[model samples]
Target: MRVTTQNGRVLLQNDVVNAAPVISTSELRGLGMESVAYIRAVEVEGEAGFAIHAADGTPMAVTEDRETAINAILQHEMMPVPLH
Candidate 1:
């Protein structure tokens, strides 16, 4: 999934559809979901925002803050994958 930064923290892409943000940048450090190179839309309701699964479905993002969460299309690339 696309990744960006707010205050320098590595954040996951909001979403590419509807120009919405995947995760709220308000009181948080990066995304709670695992890391992915892409994003996807899921079928759900409020407080159950959309779902973004990683290539391997390992790193997924989910927000219960609002009814619907939409990520933007323009996004920044993530830093070179860090070596664990």
Candidate 2:
């Protein structure tokens, strides 16, 4: 629902969920480039979750599930624009 930087600076912060991803690290990383960090509020089987991904879709970490996942996502301090 919200996107912010690692330093707590917000970019495209929002209270509601986004139907589509703000950005996909997997696609960008495939181009042989790497930078920044990002996380997303994802849904699986109608459940809410979060995925911590590097600029290249390599998961740095992922939350357990539901609130735990959301909490973990909240801690993301995206170092670059990708994360925001």
Specify the highest-TM-score model's number.
2
Report the lDDT tens digits of candidate 2 across residue range 4-84. 764443356666565543444445566533545566767757766677666666676656554554345456544433344
Residue-level error in angstroms, candidate 1, position 39: 1.2
| Alpha-carbon RMSD, each predicted model | 16.3, 13.3
Instruction: List, residue by residue over 10-44, the lDDT tens digit for candidate 1.
Output: 66765456564434433323542223234444446
State the C-alpha lDDT per candidate: 0.40, 0.55
TM-score between candidate 1 and the true structure? 0.25
Off by over 4 Å in 1: 1-35, 46-49, 63-84
